[model samples]
Target chain A: MDKLLLLGDEALAQGALDAGLSGAYGYPGTPSTEIFEYVQHSKEAARRNVHRTWSANEKTAMEEALGMSYTGKRALVTMKHVGLNVAADPFMNSGITGANGGLIVAVADDPSMHSSQNEQDSRHYGRFALVPVFEPSNQQEAYNMTFDAFALSEKYKTPVIMRLVTRLSHSRAGIVRTKYLNENEIKLPDNPNQFMLLPAFARVKYKNLIEKQELLEKESENSKYNEYHDGKDRSLGIITCGLGYNYVKENHVESKCEYPILKICQYPLPRKLIQKIIDECDEILVVEDGMPVIEEWLRGYLDNCLKIKGRMDGTLPRCGELDPAKLRTALGLEPYPIKEVPTIVKGRPPELCKGCPHRDTYYALNEAMKEYGPGHVFSDIGCYTLGFLPPFNAINSCVDMGASISMAVGAADAGLFPSIAVIGDSTFGHSGMTPLLDAVNSKANIVAFILDNGIVAMTGMQDSAVTGRVEDICMGIGVEKEHIHVINPLKGHHEENVKIIKNEINYNGVSVIIPRRPCIHIAAKLRKQK
Target chain B: MKKNIILAGVGGQGILSIATIIGYAVVKVDIYLKQAEAHGMSQRGGAVESHLRISDKEIHSDLVPHGRSDMIISLEPMESLRYFPYLKPDGWLITNITPFVNIPNYPEMKHLLKEIKAHKNSIAIDGDAIAKEIGSPRSMNMVILGASAPFLGIPFNMLEDSIRAVFGRKGEDIVQKNLDALNRGRDFAEEYIKK
Candidate 1:
């Protein structure tokens, strides 16, 4: 097998393809976006005619993956940590329905908020739904475990989640190719009620889920992803989970670590192994990235007054991503003498590109809403979220994917005058359409500015679901004909656009003023393609 | 041999191209290599960095630890200063003298130049000027790559081959311009070190 240098995301994508993946689904999300992109660009996937298409939203993506799994063809659905929240409803129920085919939800969590709003560990979601979760410590394991996760999912007829963090997802390493397995033939569920979730059937499925927990625990104990390395030191037994193993190993790069180590990259706690390590060592230091999930569990599960250490006991930080330096301090290793960055280094925050349409849109909105005062323009997740930053503090809120329109609807219902929502064209297609329908149904007094930049400019310009369909989606959602307006967002059209924005805000009953312009990068891309 | 190098530049400045070329060169020698990158939100003209590790033995950490990096290669002057703490006390700092002045509070150029020059082992070459002289201003990244190529511990021909392999698809004219850019940059660095 030829060794190819690939990012961790690419490794997982290649692993899935080699393991007989029939379809790959995901909405574009940082750290997770590249997974789908790799499959889309792969010659082998293209040759095999794998179902590789970007979904409109996370929820829609999750359902389509489930549908593929229903046909007994292996499917992999991917998303970032926050995107999981959008897909939570379908994700929670997939556990009950189970999988006829191998189903793996590849979730990349951003710890330390590198490119995310929060560092939510998806393992909690895995545990909540009573499904198996696999967290890979390195790129090779990211590949190896993803390949194994499919068979594991099909073995128990359950959906499995393979979780990796920001560092691992974006990091690059060499991956050895595995044998290519043929894609599964289309085969439906054996049992008739396998997918039926009516009250009576749901109760039975829920019971089965509960009964499988012990077996899952045993599977974790035997999982090659989870290992126990005996160390000479008995004073401390270190429990390193997923990326934590890398951080801990970073400290012992030259020599082997002395502490007894339990490296866990799989779920269900692996009770027997935990017991063995705890019995041998004086105190247990649980070093897992993201939240102190393992530490919290070990503390509550074991009543044995064992001194537990981790983010909980301040051995490591409570939040943010873990790195080699953080582990060095906790391991009581001597710190590397470091030079402090010179004071002359100024902060250079990420900003809108020079010719970005969002800049012109924010400039006009800031002007139009000047008399209405600040804190009324509710915005959502996108490049437009940067409007909250300096020089263009036009947006107020950035809670989730499509919360801008809905939050504006709620605030306007509570009598906030001149309520406005600032959402990107791609975001509107994701979760903004339903909330827009709510505005139309309630006759809410609000103006939603759908900044149509022709594509999903953020996350490296993926195809936007509503690129040219923004106006039609609003029309279908019952938006008034006169209330909808589309205008160019440019320096030359600034006055005309501002007038349209002001008029819409005054119209009061659900007006959508769209500032339509192709993103600067996309325009450049089109020219190159041409 | 082991090398932990931090490549720093503004997003869209093509620091990744430099990393990619080096990545290919390291792979040519059949060595273990890992690169950690900052993507998504940070790429919007933000201060961006990449950690690249190449070793003969098995590599553990994807990230380079503080004060352990063997060299710092940057395409921007201020960006080169931004990651100075990552450079070892005896490490080399090879950076472009060009200023990508995107921020309002960009330090005074003379002061920034002084900070980079004050480093015991450093090379600040005007890569943009060299690329322009070579009649290919767009090849400035390759110029920076060439100037830092000596410190990379890879054979010169390997990087030249890497440049050819990476840019070969673009056509022979573009390839020749880049090769010229690389040679011009390496020439400038060699002359500066002698002074």
Candidate 2:
């Protein structure tokens, strides 16, 4: 067996490759981004001509992967937790349609909101969609489970969700790879209507999905990733889920553990093993990252007599990633005496780079909107989202991807004059086009600033889907041609850029201003490569 | 034996490169190592730290537990102090003396230096100056790595070999320059500790 030092995300990529992955689709995001990156950079993937590229957004990625699966090929889709929300449409529907070949959805969740707006657990989505979910506890498991997930997917005719937390996705460890499987030949589904979802067909598919739940649970109970260990200490039974298992092992590695432990890395509750733990011990501690989905089920659904302690109670902090220190306090041990950071150590929040084009754009936008005051600009996710911070308190709202354009339209309809929207080029391609059409249809009086950095810019400069086509897309969406203006965002052109923005703000109809420049990081990368 | 180390710096400060060299060294020695890195959004000129753990046995967690770290190797002075809770009372803090003042209200240099000196075992070396003196300004991270190598439980020569292995692809010039920077940093630390 050959060993490779790989990040958890990279391990998953290798697992997919070894599992005969035919296509890999994903939009760039933290933690999950490297999975696709590894695939794209692999010589093996290149030799195989595997379909690995960035999608416009997670929804497109999801559907594209489903398309590949329909062709009787194994496909993997990667995204962050919030990206799951964007892909939820096709994702939820895919449960009923079922997978033809193997389909694996790998979502990296941020339990502490490390680089995300929210720390959502995608495990709930797995349950909601009636799909089997696999949670790997460590790097090697991430590899093994992903390779196994494909086989599991085809066995059940369902898309398998592989849930990963930030820590698991970002950490590096040596992994021993398994034997490579052959890619599936082009063979369509035996039944022509397997993917057809007309109301009549959908109803039967839905029922089939409903009937599979019991089997999924049984599979979970028998999963290799889930194990039950008996200890002499019957007073307490510890149940750890996903990455939380590591912290418990961290605490126990030094000494012999007295409490019985049930480690769960697969979904569907594994009630058989859980029940055994409950019957043997006095109380059960449900350790999990993100939301207390399992804990809530134990208390609300089972309503067992024994005490179930977890995030719902104060036993563990309600939020954030769990570490060994937190586990120490939970197990009735005193916290380690640690030196606090001195007063001289000031807070160092993440900031925009010194030469970021968004800086020039913000400076000009702030000057142009001096009369309109604050609370007028709505921004989308990107490096530009930092506009909410000080020195340039430019943007007011940042709810979701492509929310800026529609939000600004809504504000304009509410009689707020000079309603403005700031979005990035990549984001505009993702979900902004539809909202721009909505504004164009209604002729809303607003100024939309498209910050075109010629790259995705935020997630390590992935190629933007809307490269050299921002204005063309806006025009194609029915935004007036004359009202669309492109300005180069630079300190030297700040005054003219401000003038252009002010002119657009005064326009009664929907207007778009693009501040175009290469991202600093992208420019440097290009220079270095040259 | 187990060793927990926190590698701290700004996002673009080549902190992960230090982790890479050490990782390569440990892998060759057939020891287990786990490095948890910060990526994506934080890389836009924000503070970042990589938790590097090396041991003979398995490492369970990606994070270094608070007050259990054996060393904090940092590229910036203030960034060095950011992980105080993670460092043991007697742990070493080897960091560059320069400041990366990306924030608006960075602390005064004197106060920052005073806080560094308050630590039980600390080395505030001029990594930037030594790198420049070695004629490789970009090798400042290598210098910081060299300064911390004495306390890393890894052999100095192993780290020197790692520098060559990690930088070999760039060119022989880069390898030699980085090697020079590492030795200079070690020389500085050997002299500074005599006091």
DockQ for all models, in order?
0.77, 0.81
- Kindly report which residue stretches of model 1 are placed more than 4 angstroms away from their true locations once superposed: A301-306, A527-530
Per-residue lDDT over A1-530 for candidate 1, one digit per residue giving the tens place of the 0 to 100 score: 87888899999999999999999999999989989999999999999999898999999999999999999999999999889999999999999999989999999999999888889999899999999999988788888887789998998999999998988999888888877899999999999889999999999999999998998999999989889999999999999888889878888987789999999988877999999999999999999889888888888855456588999878999999888888989999888877677788899999999988999999998999889899898999999899898889888899999999999999999999989999998899999999999999999999999999888877998998887788888999999889899988899999988898888888869999999888998887778889
Error of 2 at A526 (Å): 4.2
Q: Which candidate leads the pack in DockQ?
A: 2
Residues B158-183 of candidate 2 have per-residue lDDT tens digits of: 99898888999999999999999888
Candidate 2 residue-wise lDDT, A1-530, digit = tens: 75688899999999999999999999998879999999999999999999988999999999999999998999999999999999999999999999988999999999888888898899999999998889998889999998779998888889999999999899998888978998999889888999999999999999999999999899999988999988999999999888888888888776878999999998887999998998999988989977888888788865666589988788999999999898888998767789999988887777888899999999999999898777899999998998888888889988899999999999999999889999999999999999999999999999999999999888887999999999999998898888999998998998999989988888999999999888987888778889
TM-score of the second chain of model 2 compared to its true counterpart:
0.98
In model 2, where do residues sit more than 4 Å from their true spots?
A301-306, A525-530
DockQ of 1: 0.77
